[model samples]
Every structure is written in C-alpha cells, then in structure tokens.
Target: AANDLLSKAKLDASPDKVTLVIDPLIDGVTGSQSVATHLEEKRVIELVKSSYPRFQVARFSAESVAKSPIVLIGTFTAINNAGAATGPRDAYRICLALADLKTRTIISKGVARALPDGIDPTPVAFFAESPVFAKDASTDAYIKSCQGTKVGDTIDQAYADRIVVASLINDGIEAYDAGHYRDALDVYQAALKTPGGEQLRVLNGIYLANYKLHHTKAAMDAFGKVIDYGLKSDKLAVKFLFKPGSTQFSTDRSVRAPYDAWLEKISERTAAKQGCLEIVGNTSATGLPAINDRLSGLRADYVKDRLEDNEHSLRGRLIATGKGSREMIVGTGKDDASDALDRRVEFKTAKCAI
Candidate 1:
C-alpha cells in the first residue's frame, strides 16, 4: 500500500538502486554463514556488481547501513530462546536499531508477526523496486532443516528474555517515579529473584532506592551485587567520574564499589588469560573536548595503576588509558552530578588469542 502511494506520487526511486541491510551474522566466520550474512556477502554483493545490477543488494556493517539511503532488512522470526516461537522484544530492538540508521524507507518481512505489548506497527517507507525477504522456508523446508527450527527457536527465546528484563526494569522505574519507594523496592527485589533477572541493573536500582530511603546498609549490600555481577563479565565495566576537575570518586561510596570491583575483576581475569591487562578510558560530555580526552586517558591509567599495585593477581595484569568525557551513558546535559555518570574509567579484559 505504501509502495502504491509512492508510485502514484512518482516519488519512488528507480528499482535498480535500492539496497538492503540484513541482520548481523553470528555464525563463525567460516561456517556456512547464516542466511542474513550469506545473502549480503554472496547474493546481494553479486547483484550490486552484476551490472549497475539495476537493483543492488548488499550486507553492510551496521554503521554503513545506518548511513545508507535505502536499506532492506531481513530477519528470521525467532520463535523463542529455545527456538520455538517468534520473540517480540528482540524483533523490536532490531527494528529500532535499523530505524536509527535514518533510512528513508525500511521494509520488514514482518514475519515474527507480533510486536511486544508496547510496540506499535507503524509502516515504514521504502524506495521502489526493493523487496524484503520475510517468508519462512516452506513449512516442509523448516521441518527438513532441523537446524532452521533451532535457529528460529533461539531467536524467540532471546526475545523473551529481553522482554522479561525490560518489563521488570520498567515496573521498578515506574514505581520509583510514583513515589512508592517501598513498592519500587518490592518490584526490584522480585525482579532480581526472577530466573533471568537483570542482576546488575536490579542491584543498581535497589541501591538507588535504598539510598533514597536512608537505608544505608541495604544500599551498600545492593551495590555489592552490582560490583559482583559486573566483575563477572568482561564487557561490564565499573565507571566513576570525578566532580568536574576533582580527583575524588563519587562521594557516594556505594557507587564506587561496583566500578572498583569491576576493575579488580578485569585485573584478575587478565592475569589468568593473558598475564597482562589493558584499560581503556573514555570521557563524558563535560569539560573542553581536548581536556576531556586527556582526562579520560588519565582516568583509565589511574585505574590500571591502582589495580597493578593493589590487586591480588599474580601477574598484576593492568594498564591505564584516559578518554576524556566524550562517551556518556546518559548525556551530560543534565544540570549537575548526573553528568558524573559519564566521566570515568573502564577496565576491559584483553583477550589473548592463541
């Protein structure tokens, strides 16, 4: 229907130039890549090179795709994490990310069918002659490709987990905003107990709530969980920013432990994996660009020094980097301390590949 409207208005582009972006390929680079990647590397690229190919198809890095004029996205409707039913949250996140690319038009196979409770199914615009692959292999093909079903099931299950986590967070936040501190605590606690509870986020929220309610010890305990869980995952980093130019960590000690624990964990992991560790630094959007950059690097270096000197690692794996305030989790535009969230050090485990 949208295409028809575009054609009637003569606004659609010539079919030959339309391009598509598919899902990220996670299969090992050597494996028969997943359909999404295979189409881009083999089929789409072929079309692009085949003769102006009238219509070009390609798989692009997410960054490139986001900047492309036209893009078609292909995704299998994930049934469940176990690969049973299509997932709602995962699909929405994928679509939302693509929408971020600012493509003039986006067409989905829309196969997963259902959007989560809050997602609206507004149609996106697309250029002429672009076709998005949305259909499942015939039901028979699905059955024959035993692994196909597995793939679908996994997608759905991942979605389910994402939704579960999101929903819990939403409930907690809503309770907090409504001034129901006890209720918010209850919701957060319940979420933490759920099987796929967002351990880190929940702990963070619980700490914040306890802080607000004057439950200092409870807040500290909750903060400890954030530190513990964050330490367990290399990608998770504990960040602490100073107040503007000050060197002190957050006056809130509860806030410091999680980030500190994460750095300590990285030191421990790196010592075990590579006998050494590298710390990267980033800055929030606060100070001058040059100063922030320098400061960020220094902050990372500072963490490395602390870890190298004090951590229990046998090899004392640690390094420092300063990335001044450029990368803010939440923007630094807020009037005060919220900006502090963005200023800090991040410790990452350097993978030592054999």
Candidate 2:
C-alpha cells in the first residue's frame, strides 16, 4: 500500500522539493470550527520531513503551488459524541490527495479516520490509523473501496455546507478584484446565509464590500462583528499607502483624507469594544530587507500614534509591529497602486483570555 501510494504520488524519483497545502478542516457539526486540522497537517509535514531528508518543504499558496506538486490534506466529516453514552466526544474522517499541478490530476488519494473504541468511547480513546490501499487494485479502485468503510457513530450533516460557503467567498473575492463592489456585496450576503457563514474571512469580505460601495453604516457594523469575535488570526487591511522609501503617509490630501476617516472609524470601534489591537505594517518588495523592516516598523508606530490620538483610551491596548516586505500579499514589488495592498497597514485583534 505504501509503495503503490508513493509511486502514484510521483515521488518515486524523489523530488527535491514539495509543497504542502492543508485546507482548514471544518467541524462537521459546527461547520465553522476547525477540528484539530492544523495539528494533523503539522504531523504529516513532520513525517514527510523526517522521511525525506533531502526534500525542501514549503507552505502551499495559490501562487506557490502552481509550479509544483502539492500534498493536500483536509477533513471531509466529523462527528461529536461518536459511540458515547453521555459525555462530549468527537471524531474526524480525513482525506489526503497528492495532485500534480502540471497535469491538474489527483495522482494519489487515501482516507483515514479517528474512531472511538466502543468500550471506551472517549475522545482520548479515539484511535486514528494510517491510510491503507487495497492490494491488486488500481489507485481509483482502492480509493473507492476505502470509501465504503464506516466506523463513526454519528454522521456530520453539515459537512458539505462549508464547501458552499467557501465557494461563495471565492466568488465574492473575484468580484471585489474586478471592481464590482455591488456584486461582491451580493455574494457575501449569500455566503452569510450558509453554515459557518460568520467566519472571519466572510465577515472581512462583507466589510470590505460594503466599504467599497460607500455603505458606511453597514461597513462599520460588519467591522464591529469582526471586533466582537476577537480572533487574533483575522486581519483587516488599512490602505494607508506610503511614499516609496518614506515612513510618512502620501502627501495628497485626497488620498490622506479617506485613510484619516478610516482610522477614525477604527478607533471609535476599538474603543467602543474595549478591544486590544496589533498594528502590523508591511511594505512592497522594492528595497533592502533592513530598510523595509525599519520603514515598516515606523509606519506601524505612526498608525498606533494616530489611533491613540483619536481615542486616548486605547493608549495601552495597542501594539505596533513590522513584517517588512517578507509577507507581501502581492509579490510584484511595484511601488504603485496595483501593489498598494502590499504596502499597507493591517489591524489584527488580540486574543483575549476567557
């Protein structure tokens, strides 16, 4: 089973590098919560790294995976209280696929499950096994045969619902990129109706779409939702474009006025929620790493000062940091409007203790 899977994955020649793309695994019951999916991805990556010492590993992004093979890991189903009489318990069925980006075909596929022991039926008692392939069967046939085995006691009804929401989110992003604010808003609204609709990414899209359409109240409301959630991973882009090699905001009044308005709204919202924030500054890949890092740090400090000025109560709740050009969303490095997103500030909510 192992040899066949590797052969199908085209790792027979032992490629020097591979990209790992692990999508967030949705809780089958909640549809929005991740079911230890990130941990699973990390385990797999560690296994690969230890098994293949010569191969370099990189995180998979849409752009980065286009030129290489990708190992895709995700969970399709999860069940809570599987085989349990009364306590809280859960299990997940995960799928792994190796796809050849050049051919756009899934070269190999397998599935595994975390199942509770009938006698124990506790979360800790749940055992997960490595994927296996059927002997003397083709890759497609093995995959089909493995799909028939069922062990979990409860089935996830909302398993496929998240995919619909994901599709809508993608469509909204495409619309926004095409300058169709109204269309993007419509798509975001539709996504909000589905299971897991209140995800941070979805809310961010709604806020951005509303802002673009000049719906100030709606945008602020959406932004408030984001603050209320307070997930540290969520980031809202602040289009505070800076002059090349300068830490100051653009000199144009027209450009500066809108950003000033945005800052005011952000300050009001943060103060109202008593929320702590992380002001992250970024730059386009146009200069030396040391210079970019310094400039980005200064820009973040500038934003922090402005926010505190707008709302003095936020003085101790904000932190300023810089990532330089190392984390550019667009790697073009062009210091222009087209690469403006790469040269902007981001506001990330700080995680609060329960």
Best by TM-score: 2
Candidate 2 ranges with C-alpha deviation above 4 Å: 1-161, 170-183, 226-239, 251-257, 326-342, 348-354
For model 2, how does the per-residue alpha-carbon lDDT over 266-322 read when each residue is reduced to its tens digit? 798888878888898998767788988999999999999999999999988999999
**RMSD to true structure for each model, in Å:** 17.6, 18.0
Q: How far in Å is the alpha carbon of 214 misplaced in model 2?
A: 2.9
* Residue 103 alpha-carbon offset, candidate 2, angstroms: 23
Q: In lDDT terms, which candidate is top? A: 2
Error of 2 at 88 (Å): 47
The digit string of per-residue lDDT tens for model 1 on 1-354 reads 112211222124655455544333221111112333333334434544663344444434334444543333233222233432322122311211111123222222222233334432211111000011111212122122222232112223332233344356556755675567788788788887776665444666687677678887786666555544544555444545455565555565633444454445445545545454456676655458898777777666666676675556523455566656444443314324322334545545555433
Clash count, one per candidate: 33, 0
lDDT of each: 0.43, 0.56
Model 2 TM-score is: 0.48
Q: What residue runs in model 1 are displaced by over 4 Å at the alpha carbon?
A: 1-156, 162-165, 250-277, 285-290, 305-315, 325-342, 351-354
